[model samples]
Target: MHEGATLGRRFTTLRAEPHDVPGVDRWVALDARRDVEVTVDILTSLAPGAVRQAAVRAAQVRDARFARVLASGRENVGSDRVTYVVTERPHGVRASDLIHERVVPPRVAGAIVGEAARALQVAAGQGIHHGFLRARAITVADGGRVVVSGLDAEGELATQAGLGRGRTEQADAAALAHLYLALVTGMESEQVTVPDLPDALSLGAANLARAAIAGTGPDTLAQVAAAMGPPDPAALRGLRGSLPSLPAVAHEEPQEPHAPIAVSPETLAAAEHQTELSIAAAVAAPGVAAEVAAERIVAPELEPGAAVDRSLYASPEEAAQFSRRTRKAVERERDQPLALDTFEEINEEQNAGDDRSVVQATLEFAQRHLPRNAPLDAAVERAQDRAGRSGPLSTGPLLVGLFATALLIVGLVAFNMLVSPVPMDGLSTREPDYPAYTFSPAPLPSASPSATNTE
Candidate 1:
């Protein structure tokens, strides 16, 4: 047992032996300061230098949804050699566990796929790929938060071990679709019967899943995420059905505190017997026959090769007629003004007469109020003569000069108010009144000065 063994400088105090991770053996360990838990993968079967390359590639990934890598190194203990890769331990149960237990509802499953798709999209932007995405690699945290582990490092390790088949954006989409199907049907299989999906699930979800599974849907993860839209928490909760609890694993005699316990033959037999008995009981239960019949009636056979033509035109005449109708519809839509635009046009037309009347009234008022006067006419003539002499004053310079004069006056006023202090002498000279008190004087002793002369 290497419970207290430390790996890299940051990760110290291994708390457990290598357990089952998606593509590698994972050991839970405390960080250097023991502040948080981290997982370390010992890639013993991977080709030489695989971990190093994966570490370099993973260092560039900055997506929050990815399980961040802490460090990677090569180490040898006794006759065994392995590469260690440390990553943050996300606190959640494996998505596979939930699927096996039949806890994830259809809507929740869509949401989970959507989240994984978002993470994949982020990784794709950086040219990073998760070639080994599986139910075990995905963790479903509280509040439906999905965390994808085993990014580039797992893929590299798998390739080194000759377990990697192929990796592409299309492959990832298909795998995600398969995952969604498994969650919805609670079945672990490579192929899914689209017709078996519950009618309660939306048709859009079914189409999206079918397209992804067939590799005929959106090519990129971003498009897949967009297609899934946002998951409805209320619908998920309402539609989810209760499932039976998982049977507890039988254990043998206790061993060392952190030592691994191997399942005995007796334990395996007992577990198998229990599972068989449970299945038998479920089969013999009442309504079992009726339920199976209902399922058959609800799930219809979907022919994969069946094609439905959704085109509007089937012949040349039909095509011409459809084109003409489409053209007319478009023209009508284009020519139709919006309600606001129509209202604005009508308002302008109605206000035109009122505007002219107002202007005429203003002129008449100005004429009545500002009657012609001899003195005013003389002043205007003199102003015109001065302007002519000045070679026609520029309005721009005159306005600028007025603005500058106003600014100067404002500056002087501000300076007087802020910088200068007013004298207090002329305000008031009266002193504040207070109550007065008189003290009686005591007689002084006069013998101390004469005492020195007498001595």
Candidate 2:
């Protein structure tokens, strides 16, 4: 792990675009009601010798006093270092100011002015900062602990590190946070412990990503990573395969079988006996009988293809004596049925019929003609009702009977009310022991309504 890599990227939200003119500028803007604004001065510096842009990121962390050193003949330096002017003043130079100040010579040609414009745009939009030039160790976290068991110094493990640094591990600060998130969520206590580095990356993060770009093929770096843990780095390989243990393996030689197979004599005898019994039963028992019985059950349902027309037996003694006389008469005609042809003609006529209602009605009547034992009882009940209706006691008499019933019910209720609940305390009451009275016919008064109506 690189010492600086332990640090992660950090930032303040961008506020406003930076402008070319620089001396002191408002770094960030805010809505007074919603957001509180803070002002801080920014200064930028390159690594020893570097170029300066048109606008420094307002939020760049530096000396707070601007400083930079730009190589003059940088084109001549391809991976080669060169000497150039160094200055601490940001407002000291502007491309526009530089353009008018003195540039009569083409040898001191400038980088495209558009590049400077882009720099200004970045300052305004993205809020450029010192960290963008070189990854700075801005991110901070407590380095919890370091536990190393396998690998050692000299870039070695329990085995050894490659002759050179095997690989450069690339990871973002978000990736570090994501890893801890997974570990915490999945309850993963195990972690990788790598060599101490800067940026506050703990052993957990230090060894999290370690691979080699220096090597030609994966053999060296891959072997180191392979030795470190499982062979593949899912995030690196651009795949997601399980880091689970390899399928189980049996390295030992398989045992050879003995010449004579060993078995219990009784077990063998039992198996042989069962097999013999099954075979004997199959050979002797009637398997075909069940099949024959099923065939017999199906026999009554089909007509024989070679059967003579049934009319041939008509008027024969058997036909005269046949139990169903109607069918006998049907069979007697010389114009007897040619069944298959007759059925086809009948079907065609039925299909062509225009009177669909009559067809439906005939089918309904045919269905109803079938006798039902359940309905016999219902028929008897209907007959009883008809008999009752036909009798001399007609609807008028029924009304009279109903009126009489109502009067009887009212009389019973009135008599019950007049009787006392506490009569003789329910036990002391004794009826007068006397002969029951027979009423003599007393004539209703001649002036009553019945008598007057008769008159």
lDDT per model vs. reference:
0.64, 0.29
**lDDT (Cα, tens digit) per residue for candidate 2, span 220-305:** 22222222332121222211121122122123578997699675444344344445445555565487544444433111333667
Model 2 spans with C-alpha error above 4 angstroms: 1-35, 38-41, 44-455
Model 1 Cα lDDT, one tens digit per residue, 286-381: 666455444331223448986633231134454455556767988999999987687667655554432233444555455447644323333433
lDDT of 2 at 411: 97
TM-score between model 2 and native: 0.12
Q: What are the models' TM-scores?
A: 0.48, 0.12
State residue 2's C-alpha deviation in candidate 2, in Å: 36
Clashes of each: 0, 12
Best by TM-score: 1
